[model samples]
Target: MSSPWFGSQRSQSMTEFALVAPILLLMLFGIIDFGRLLYIYGTLVEAANEGARVSIKASSPLPSNSDVENAAKNGAQSLYLANPCPNGPLPPTSGAGAQNPPGDQGWIFITEPNPPTTVETSPTYDAPGGQSPASATGSCSAINPFQSGTYPLQVTVRYNYLFFTPLLEQLAPSIILQAYATDYTEY
Candidate 1:
């Protein structure tokens, strides 16, 4: 009789573990996914900075430089994603990294002073990086053509994250991470 009771207790423990394990695993994946998203976001920001620096490399090139853009894209490829940006992917128009797919491109946002217009950019990222990637024009101080001569350039890169758990999916159908870095260019 004691043997049967002990066996029943052990079975109950296993049942409890089975019930709790999935939730715990899900939580663990959620934590990992979130951490990865943050890391990717930072990487994108760095990539943008690299790209923005490209414009200032030679004090501006004619009609923008595609090689400069590729340098930015290559910098981002270091953190290459298995499931690149699904929200939007912009292809390299020209330069070294032109062979890369649209999903692996870095986007540029140029706002010239006084009614800024987009100088060069991808199809999906025609807008500037605002307060947040999604914000409009970043609530930025109005551009002054008389005072500031430099063109404000922002590089925005996107990354698509594949989630292992459903928790993250509930937040969004597909996790598209974005990073932006802004710089001033005389050109």
Candidate 2:
């Protein structure tokens, strides 16, 4: 024979679980959304790097704009889903917005003359504790002229990531994930 307190223990446990379930579910959704965000960001970064790599290859003829764009598309082929965010904002073409210009893949931007200054970049071009790489006087010369030394090439990929959770959408909407890769020609 159990006391009244023990008799109601199962109900108490049920009540506690009912109170905590929503919060726990919310946390679980948040973790999943965070993981998705990271995956998208990593994909964008690799796509941009692939575009830059295509542009800077030591091959005789330089890669055309379309070629680089194709490389980027191939790099991010996993994200070729049917509109991840149909209701969300579209990527901006210029200005303080997304800065994603029109490309074969729609979100890749290429700059062959100088590295982009809009986003934070790692100092991969410079030696440890050494001076940053500077643009030379004839850096932007035509390929026919074939200027000496290394020339900078930058590729950028912008993606509008929509949260899978409805709570996240109400709180912050979509996040614009931008990635940039800069490389120099092997001369």
Q: Which lDDT tens digits does candidate 1 get at residues 27-82? A: 88988877866766777777767766764443322224354455566667566532
Each prediction's whole-model lDDT (CA) = 0.48, 0.58
| Steric overlap count per candidate | 2, 0
Q: What TM-score do all the candidates reach, one by one?
A: 0.57, 0.66
lDDT by residue (1-187, candidate 2, tens digit) is 6686566677889999999999999999999999988988888888888977876776645465566777888888776422221111333534665433222223665554443333323222321011123332221211221233576766767776778889988897767677878887664
C-alpha displacement of 95 in model 2, angstroms?
A: 8.9
Best by TM-score: 2
For candidate 1, the lDDT comes to 0.48
Error of 1 at 63 (Å): 9.4
Candidate 2 lDDT trough over 10 residues, lowest sum = 123-132
